[model samples]
Target: MKFFDELKARGIIDALSNEEELEKKFNEGGMSFYCGYDPTARSLQLGNLFTIITCMRFQKAGHKPYMLVGGATGMIGDPSGKSEERNLLDMETLKENIDAIRKQLGLFVDFECGDNAAVLVNNADWWQGLGFLEFLRTIGKRFRVNEMLNKDSVKSRIESDSGISLTEFSYQVLQAYDFVTLNKLHNVSLQIGGSDQWGNMTAGTDLTRKMNQNQVYCMTMPLVTDQNGKKFGKSAGNAVFLDGSMTSPYKMYQFLLNQDDAIIDALLKYYTFLSLDEIAELDSKTKNEPHLRLAQKSLAQEVTKLVHGQEGLDAALRATQFFFGEKIENVSDADVASIFEDTPSVELSSEMLNEGGVIDMLSETPLFKSKKEVRRAIDQKGIYINNVAIEGPTQTLSKADLASETALVLRKGKKNYCVVKFK
Candidate 1:
């Protein structure tokens, strides 16, 4: 399929400026394209994943892709889609962030290849050297204040209690200047971003045409959300970071694997490059056995492999198996620790285990409702240690019960697993 056609099929084409003209330019082949990333944080979130992948796809289709890290504009945060003004980053912090982002981008695309070789750019390179008066004369004069006030990003903030700042209000003009710079220096013809960027992206296209009388393309991908309409890419109030240090590979794997059934199809379409035939088969399998969650697993595998690589993907799969699969009894303590590294854990003193009964530990540690409940569970043979059933009614804990001299795995039922670490 043609690249744009594929984009539409995958539901990645949320908006495009002058579709026919853009298609004509794309047909010319070897066109230049660019995507921007703001260094608002130390690491990019999963929300940034699809856009970076889109840039890679453009390169694969024989177009040059330039990845722009917003070093200059990042210091002055974009007011687009914001409810309040963002604090500006210091120049030193922004430079460090830019370098970190560039390293992360290198893992996905190559830079040594010719023609369609991927390029890394920092907008500060140009934005820093320009005199304030000169910028106003050249780029600033092209944009009208009334025209800027009408964009949705600006209007929403204006209508709210948390008003926009002048610095953030000028974001569209700065972004437009990014497009103009890329077009002039690299011959880039297209700019792509999330749906939130529609107004700013169009501004870039308009500025390029008016300033140099040249045609450019603009496209955006829709916002991703869960079945209940909650946004994706966040875990427990924090964003799921692409960097392993920020978010572990195991956690990233689980994020995709646990996707709600309603959102899996859309996610598969946007994230994976699975062939149409393969996707159809997966879809059929899903319809036939929704409970099996085959499609969700496939989506998780493909995405995990793409972002974290094979080793990371394997660790994630191992984690899944240890958590939900059979043969838990055969697993090692080290493996269990690896899988449940970030989970809530309790620490108990060895002396307490030796002097106190199982009931006392269960009640005192808040693992059970009461001593009576603990007795009932024990009577039903539901209490287990390291997947082995306990036989003694007067079971007294000892150092030997601790796994690896410091930890004990508690299994209250088939699914509930807890760990007690010795201090």
Candidate 2:
């Protein structure tokens, strides 16, 4: 299939400039495209992964990707999606962030695919030593203040209580200049970003036209949201960090696994490389047999494998199975912590591990609440430790009761679980 048709079929195209010409360029299949990221965070989050996957699609279609890290722009925040202004980072921090992002970008796109390889770029390389006054006179003079004021990003900020700062207002000029620079240096003709960036991205295309008489294309993927119309990702209050140390594979998998049934088809298309036909089948299963959660599992597995690796997916699957009551013996501390990071936890001294009984230990936490509750749960066979049903309520905790190095799982009923940690 042609690239544009696949993009349309997958529902990936939110907005783009010059649809006919861009489609022609996509069909011709040898143009260079670019996606820019400002190092606002040391690690990219789930929202950024959507664009990365889109770049993967482009690369698979025989196009080159220029992954641009905005070291220069990170120093002055983009106010496109913000009500309040962004906190600017210093040079040292920006350098560290750019380096980290450069490394993370490697995990997604191929930096060495021969002629079609991805190129990691830092805009600071070009923007650093340019004379501020000269740039303002040459490039800044091209933008009309009326058009700048009319941008949704700028208009909203201007009408706000804080108002927009001069620094942020100039962000578009910097971003626009990036396009012209890339077009001159690398023959990059297309730019892709999230829907929120429509204003800033189009600014690049227009600036490219006005400055050098070159036509560049811009495309955006819609900012994904759930059924309730709340803006998704970090804005939805369920932010997942792309860095493994920040968010574990099990957590990322679980996050995708809990999507609403109504949005699975859209999410599978956006997050996974699955064909529309495959997503349609999953969507059918989701509607017919919601209980099996086959669609959700596939979404989780494909995304986790892409972000993390097959090994990470395997670990996540084992952790998921362990959560669902499959016995996992000799569980390590990292697995327990990562798997149960959000589970309610209570810390007790090592003395409790030796002297305290299960009833006493569980009673200390909000889970069991009281000795009577623990005793009742025990009597009813509703209590489990490390997924194993206890023999009786009379036994005390010992070193052997520890599922990992310093923690043991406590449960009341099937779903209620607490991680009891010993110092």
Candidate 3:
């Protein structure tokens, strides 16, 4: 398949301005393209993953990709898809966010691929030195206030209760000037963004044509949403950040693993580099045997590997298996802690274990409500110590039973589990 054809086949293109011309340019090859990311947060969230992957796809097709960090524009937030004006970040926070995001982008794009290697550029480098008068006479003269007001980003905000701020209202103009600057400095001819960025992206193309008389292009990918129409990349109102410290690899894997089956096929298209035939095969299996969750597992594995690398994927798998009757006898203390990080836990002094056995321990902790409940659970063979079924309530917890001499794994029936840490 041709490069552009593959992009369309994978459902990556939401809308492209001047498709015929862009298609010709793509076929000729060696076009430089850019996607802008604002430093609004400490890490790029799952919402940003699709654009990064698109850049990777373009780079693999022999095009140079520019990862543009909006250091200047981030200080004045973009109003697209926002309900109200965003809080401005101080210079310290913006710089920290830019540095962190640059590192994360490196994981996705090849920075050493010779000519086509991805380049990281910050808008602040150009915007910082321009005086207000120069900016007004040069870039500002090209924009009309009436046209700016017609933009969806501005129109929606103007009608809202909070209204629009002049700072945010001029964001499209800044983004437009970025295109002109990139065109002049890097010969960048294409800009890619999310569907919500359609207005801002078109503004850039327009400014580029008016200023440089160059035909630059803009393409957008559809905003990802779940079966319920909720956007992806959020968990409990907080975004799923790319940084492992912000959103753990284990948690990211679980989030993908738990995706609704109804949305898995579409998600596979957006999230993975798997071939269409491979995805089709997985889709068939999903329909035939939904219980196995073949598609969901593959999506989790592929995306987790992309974001966190192979070792992170392995850790996520290990964390997952820990709950599914996996043996805990040889598990490391840190691994055990990570696996049960979200599970119920009780810390007990080392001396408590010597007073009695497993029965005495359960009677004291909240794992069991009362001694009678503990006895009942043991009688039904529903209790496990270190993943080994307890013979009865009398079966004692010796030092030998502790995994890594730090913790004991206790389970009730098939799903519920708790960790007992010895201090």
Give Cα-based local distance difference scores for all models: 0.80, 0.88, 0.87
**Cα lDDT of model 1 by residue, 142-230, tens digit:** 99899999999999999999888889999999999999999999898899898889989989989999997888889898977756665
Clashing pairs in 3: none
User: Model 3, 185: alpha-carbon shift in Å?
Assistant: 0.4
Which runs of model 3 end up more than 4 angstroms from their true locations?
234-238, 329-342, 347-356, 391-408, 421-423
TM-score for model 1?
0.87
What value of lDDT does candidate 1 attain over all alpha carbons?
0.80
Q: Which stretches of candidate 2 lie over 4 Å from their true place?
A: 328-335, 369-373
Which portions of model 1 show Cα errors greater than 4 Å?
233-238, 325-344, 349-364, 369-380, 386-408
Instruction: TM-score for candidate 2, please give it.
Output: 0.94
lDDT of 3 by residue, 1-423 (tens): 788887888889999999998887776679999999999888888878988998988898889999999999999999988878888999999999999889989989998999998899999999999999999998998889999999998999999999999999999999999999999999999999999899999999999999999989999999887666766543325467888877778888988888899889878988899998999999999999999999999999999999989988987897787677877776667666656777888888787666357777887776788989999998999988877898876676667878766888888889888889888
- Give the candidate number with the greatest lDDT: 2
Error of 1 at 170 (Å): 0.9
Candidate 2 lDDT, tens digit per residue, 202-298?
9999999988799899999988876676665553466788987778899999988988898888889999988788889988988889999999999
Better of 1 and 2 by TM-score: 2
Task: Give the clashing residue pairs of candidate 1, or none.
Answer: none
